[model samples]
Target chain A: MTYQSRYAWSVLFRLFHWAFALSIVTLVVTGLYVNSPWTNTVLEGSRSFPMATMRYLHFLAGFIFASAVAVRLYLWLFGNRQEKFWDSAPITPRNIRNLFSTMAYYTYLTDRHETRLGHNALAGTVYLATIVLTLIQLVSGFYMLYPESVFWQKWGVALFETQQQARFIHHLLMWYFIIFAFFHLYIVIWNDIKSPEGLISSIFCGRKFHRSSS
Target chain B: MTRHLDKSHFEPKLSRRGFIKGCTIAAAALGLSDEMVPRLVEAAASAQKPPVLWLHFQECTGCTEALLRASHPDVGRLILDMISLDYHETVMAPSGNQAEKSFKDTLEKYSGKFICVVEGAVPTKDGGIYCKIGGRTALEIIREAAPKAAAVIAIGTCASYGGVQAASPNPTGAKGAGDVLGMPVVNIPGCPPNPIAFLGTLLHFLTFKRLPELDQIGRPLFAYGRKNHDQCERRAHFDEGRFVEQFGDSNHMKGYCLYKVGCKGPETFANCPAVRFNDVDVWPVSAGHGCVGCTEPNFWDTHSPFYERLPGVKIPGTGGIVHDVDSAGKKILGIAAAAAGIHAAVGIGKRIVKGRGKSDEDV
Candidate 1:
């Protein structure tokens, strides 16, 4: 057997991927703490803002997560053909067929997944949905920051009707990310082992291994 | 009928100083400049007081009690001098047929000119038979009067968003006045709303001849403009992360933030912190109890399990099965993890068996 190492991900794509993942992790950790503070650092006559600190970190990471999402969306529109959204995401009829085939492969109805360098159609669609969820989380978060501000009041607070409603939506989505992270890790690791492509390393090194001949 | 002697009987006996002081407080509450005090005084002294027909439905009269309890500038004098209380069910001197006649006369006299203040939830279920006053359902009464009034004010949470009566399993199908009337009504939503908030709204209407600026929920922005957390006296404690762990702990004595013990201040938008109830510098948070978030719409349902950080989500179609969000989230994640583990084990096992068979063929 012979294999070829091909450049699969753009440098910017890799950067956005890592930034998004890191920030999402940071956000979930800090957000959970903010939702229900587990630590009570009440020293005698002492003052510390663990909740405030967690919130500040959460907000800071939220901005980074939003910006990373923006970069990914921009790359989807204008990037190397492989990095473009359509390369993996099933938008057209042919791609939709590929998506079902990929699902069949995952469900063990088929022994083979279609050969693709980037995300399989199902993964791509899930990522697209994730971007949408991230946007909702951002809107909900930003609205709560300045509930009194005219801009947010009109767009965020009023739209949600109450700050708690927005908070609930935001909190609900946090669990989604947690569940997503679990499935995401398991599947990606499975791919790294089972698939011919250097799946996991491709994210870090921007290269994938493909069988040249066997 | 003997001709009523002493026209002064109709006039409120307010001392000029107290009247001026009251005007100042009103101006402040209305977010008007100090210069607006004289204008407020002038508005109050003007002979043409707006006729207010206050209606009570499924309520405890707490809003009225709070209003009457205002001591500074004497809210009793303010209410009497500023607006002609045409037909408050609780405070009216007349009763039975006389009271009914007064309400009828006010409706006739002040058609399209009066302020209709509704103080409780209106029931619409079963032909609106849940709450009745003088043989008319609250729904019937509000519908008859609200459209005719210049403006409608839904005082207290009950009138604003159906309060406790409209909470889940709302057997009577209680709804707010605005919902019942199907028109915009100014909502002053608190369990027992601060008199200052109501006074501000009243004074704004009297002085400017228009309702004050209202938020999306139809609450006066001057009062419901900021969240209770923002103006909280113990805000420093919140920022500093000092919270009351329990009701009687030392932290409580230190006046720490009540966020930990389920203070809904962070979500509640009310001026309770800034304008304490009863003309004293004391609100629920100030008195060492966390805010119950009485002002926000649907507070009874949304802000309940009130002593907790978050409301328990009632699982739909589960026949009243309620679980805390955090616990439910953890359980969901745990289930996902276990499923993922099982899937991985199956996938890995299949791969090992397939690989062994393929390697034996190569050997």
Candidate 2:
């Protein structure tokens, strides 16, 4: 079979993308509880399940998220230099201007697509924000998750020792993530629906179907 | 055998001794031993019939329904007969003008003597057009009745905080009696509020000639002090973070904590978990559902989705387990703060080194 390959993403990029997406879905499912809503609940046999399980799920998901971040960083350092990190995603004045342009272009509020590799400026900025926020969640989450981890316990206590304080930070971030997620999903759907190519499957199965003739 | 044969009708009513014997039997049935029966006996013998004036306003009359179904029959009947039930619209046989006339008569005869129990909120918006009785506003009824009352009690969430009707976009601008009447209305706030809580409040008022210690909201601290979270049996699950993901799911079947799905118990302060519903130890959460925080302020608004916890409150140093919204917001905001600090440190460190380089060049 004759094949054509105009590179959209590297193999490593696709792997990181899929795994990160999966972990985020898992986190969202489990995150519903991170703050909890009920009290004085009495279940006949709910003892078999416990909070530890949810935390374990959250932490396990975090590890995968962190691994995804690690792979992205490694790709930045070791992947093809021709794929310059700063070219498409940097926050320089040029990209900052492009961020608004990309948003406008996507919304059909404008029609301008800049030459890009990987994420556009707006996408890059949001992705960076996600990474940073995820890292914060991990740091605070782990500190609360494994208070006995001597390293985390010490730092957690130094920063926020009381259980109440840790809880406050954990809960507050959950809402922020929810709001971020709603908009993030909107952008994804916007791209997937508006664009001739289905954007979601591209991330999931490693192939974007395009209307443009190859 | 009859202590009060002074009247022929009093003969069949059974004397105090026989009544005490009946009380002993009833108390024994309640898990209280014969020894503890004396407390109830003493209470009954006290012959304290606290005069109660049940006033209705803009409401569904659910509080009255709850009162009829009160668990303690002795308390209920005693409150009815032993204490002069000066006026109650639903239970009182008199109706229309006569029923309202009874209220006026009581106000005149028992001026500064009766206990006024107000149900439902007073609609103060637009000249109190929301609720009208006898061509007068509920706001007017409460104002006229409250001052002369030995103790003013606002029963149910409506009378407490205007309840579901007073929720956002409140067309009538309904407010709790305390807010509308400009007085400290002892609020017994629940959806309908546990009837026993009303009885208990009345008991304290009658026994002490004053109100029980109140929370900041003027609710009885006896009923509103501890959070449903603190008293929750599933709290251990919350501490461990076990949550029910869905209804009728395996986790729910096993009785896992409902905190994850938005139980508001952790942030809502009430005795639902301890005292429970219908004089049974089963409450909303204990029934395998999450707390809706019906007893809290703006529960319909502040606490909603029935399964989600409210925002965290602030604490000193903000320990990991705080449940207040203000505190949690501050904590999350700390994320940006940490990032800013890291950036500042990096910049400062770079500037210091650059200064050293300049100084060395000068040297």
Candidate 3:
């Protein structure tokens, strides 16, 4: 494809991007207030409105995030066939080797190798792990939240009498994201400095300077 | 009728007015006021001291300590004076073999008539060798005495559920009176049970001539009827999630609930919050440490590491954590995508603003 017409993110993925970010921010702020680390007064002094609003907002944001993730999952499953979304994160040997090599290359261990059109190998595996972790967190979180509903209560809390069990799992999930964020920042900065190109703007403006295949 | 009533100028030492005034003051202090005055007066006049045999075993004399510190002077004295105490190991001037002889004699004299009040645990290990009085194990002595008594009152945690002695790896096999004696044992359990519970049960029995209704654990339903969390004054703090994180912190001093710091009050059944202790007006939680759940069964074993919370028992759509933000679980997707997109986009924004190559590393 010509440089001007190079493929980037589809409209759905771009929309999903902004929506997920907004929802995440909302959830974090609201979640902290709900089980406040500072003071339980987040909902205090409100005759009743703020607490009820936070509860509603928390659930609503979760719904939006869940829907976006679902759509993204579908896109991963059935995009284009050959070099489609499936092949982007393939478990092939070359990709696996590249994943390790990319990690090594970032640490200045060796010279860089040829790049793939889609996600690098290490990126693909992390993607799978993140997806799996998010799915578990979502299910367990929802299960714990309303464990008493005809749904969660009748058959949920019995699985774990102590809320501590779920808390441990949930806390562990947070560290994963933070670690991922650190590595992600490192790689992007390193790549942008080396290339000096507009590779970063592809998601926003739907355009990029595509390098020719050897 | 012979005029014998008119002949004697001598009256007994006590005057009627002084005694009545003393009782009225006592009844008021017990929080039972004028409306309840007639009942108290009638009860005091009609009732005799309930015959009691206070037994001691593996104990610290704490229940006795709590009872002695009773706020109402009359109630404190009433338990001692009104009742013919037949035998009490601690307060009775008699000791050793002489005391032993008195206990046996009283058991015979008041068999099936006196209330058997047990104050401590009975070590059943190796036939109760852990604790002894008068050269006989508390177990052997109690087993012989229990069946003949009219009613058995297990007065403290030690006698109620073996107290601290029955904590994990209980080497002596300390057992409560209920388990050791086949008789009906009414448990007034606490590390040292509130004195009012003991007095209330005793007085109720004297009036009714029957044991009060007890829960499965032999605790009187009237006193240990509800979980401490249900009636605790700081309970709203618990439900609101405003917790005191440390000792002497502002929240602790402000009277916040101790549930966050491992107060087992929510799960424990007792009225300690209402009845209080030693009439000091503040208990352990008020002192900033959480409730150790001294009254509940297996309290020592089940509720340990006293500062950490009991795994929060989520009630589903009720009191529960709202999200997966413990570490970073909740924002997984956004982070993954945003890191990818933001850093990429930040690269572009830098290039447009700074005109490319002269700019800083995207790193």
Best by DockQ: 1
Tell me the lDDT of model 1 at B238.
75
Candidate 3 lDDT, B1-363, residue by residue in tens: 233232321332334453454355444334455675566555655656556789999899988877765544334555564467878877888887888788888788888888899998999999788898877899888988888888989999889888888986899999999988866799999878877777767655664577777765678877876667677887666655567777777877787767556777655667777767644566666666777778876667556656754322233585554342333343555576676667567656655876755432222
The numbered model that scores best in lDDT is: 1
Native A-B contacts reproduced, model 2: 0.15
- Kindly report the fnat of each predicted structure, to 2 decimals: 0.39, 0.15, 0.11
* Models sorted by lDDT, best on top: 1, 2, 3
Per-residue CA lDDT of model 2 for A1-214, tens digit only, reads 1223235556788888778778877776676545443333345345544455665787799789779878877776676532345645655788888888887665444433554434678877776777777666666777655533557645654555332345456666666665566556656765554343546665655455433323
Task: Specify the highest-TM-score model's number.
Answer: 1
Q: Point out the worst 10-residue segment of candidate 3 chain B by lDDT.
A: B4-13
Clashes of 3: 11
Q: Return the candidate ranking by DockQ, descending.
A: 1, 3, 2
Residue B326 CA displacement from its true place in model 3, Å: 10
lDDT of 1: 0.83
- Count of residue pairs whose backbone atoms collide, per candidate: 0, 46, 11
Q: Candidate 2 regions off by >4 Å?
A: A1-33, A36-214, B1-48, B310-363
